[model samples]
Target: MHDRGRGHERRPVTQHVVVRWKAGLPRGRDEPWFLMTDLERPARRISEPYARRMSIEELFRDAKTRRNGFALRAVRLKKADRIDRLLPIVTLAYILLVGHVRLARRTWTPGRWCSNNRPNECSDFTIGPALLDQARFKPAAALAAIRKATEEVGEEWG
Candidate 1:
């Protein structure tokens, strides 16, 4: 495909590999993923990079999305220093939520979604409520985990 109208200032894009990768594997029920890249490699090797890219993209989605994850998108931290600090804190919270999903899978009961218990279906979204319900259960451990995660940041206080 050639474009002569808009984006003419950019370099020409040569033929690229396009594939329909099934992201919801093990279940194989989700919609197909459309991936395109100009890596100039064999078709078989293309999915490797795409898979990693999708994982990273999903991480951002889980961090920013309001309905399913941390809802960090709503936060407004203008300064670069604040953003840097907030990222680590938010990441720690996200990790805690995902961790809750694992523990909740064993102890807490989930609602029926026309199917029986399937751990694959569990995610940070499902555990957000659990985190809130048990937020007061263990404060010291949560603080310890948060401090451990932020140790490399080198921020000291009294």
Candidate 2:
């Protein structure tokens, strides 16, 4: 196939692989993925990283639109210098937020905000309510409160 573009010609295809798998659907549909790569590694090796890229993309999407307003404000900046300065701050904030979410996931229960109506759907973004709930009580105090409530309700804290 001939593909010409502005200022450049299309590079030759170095590697092409088609991966197929059965989709986990009730109808048992077949899902096919086409991957083109220039790396010397095996198809499986290249495909692993390609598959993992979805999570990275999701994280950026969450940071920009779903969770934090990181990239949304960048549109207003007309100067490259301002954008360069802002990127580091946004990246640092994203890292801190992810760290906080990981910690909160370990210590706290999933809140109402984390619930989705779709069955088996889970979210990587979970810091919102966890931070709010954590702010209301210390770990020890929260545990004590839970114990007291359970005792009063004639149920054991498990």
Candidate 3:
């Protein structure tokens, strides 16, 4: 490709593939997702990574949101060292919350959600709301879950 900004320098042509996907139940409204990637993979293969990205995106969203999860944006840490110290605590807490929610999900009865509005399958994005809902009624349980997750991690490490 010709780079206009670089005084007409010639560059290698990069290719992008757009995967058009309809994401929803057969009875639900069609949610179209256009996944664009430069990775040289089949259409079906490219979509898998994009699907996995939704979880990481959700984690970021939860970390940043003021009303939902730990609003890390509200923190006043100015130094890189302080921010580094804080990240592991926040990340560990987030992971434990997710682990707790996953365990909680197994016991949850059909159509008996505490915070979910749609009554649909819960994804990682939805876990923040569900965790908040449970924390309202059971603070001890949340603490216990965190301890359990810590112990599990310790076991794996040791």
Give the range of the ten consecutive residues with the poorest summed lDDT in model 3.
110-119
Between candidates 1 and 2, the one scoring higher on TM-score is 1
Model 3, which residues run further than 4 Å from truth? Answer: 1-18, 23-29, 36-42, 114-158
- In model 1, the Cα lDDT at residue 97 comes to 61
| RMSD (Å) per prediction | 8.6, 12.8, 6.8
RMSD of candidate 2 to the truth, in angstroms, is: 12.8
- Give one digit per residue, the lDDT tens place, for model 2 in 66-154: 34434554468888998899879876655555545444555656553355333213334445334755544444544454455446646
Question: Using TM-score as the measure, what is the rank order of every candidate, best first?
Answer: 3, 1, 2
Assess the local accuracy of residue 20 in candidate 3 as a C-alpha lDDT between 0 and 100: 56
Write down the lDDT that model 3 would get.
0.63
Over 1-158, each residue of candidate 3 has an lDDT whose tens digit, in order, gives 43354677666666675655655543453565676555787776767656658756866877888866689899999999999999999876666666557556555652454343344455544564655555443546756766776686685344
Candidate 1 residue spans exceeding 4 A from truth: 1-28, 31-55, 108-116, 134-158
Per TM-score, the best of the predicted structures is: 3
lDDT of model 2 at position 56: 72
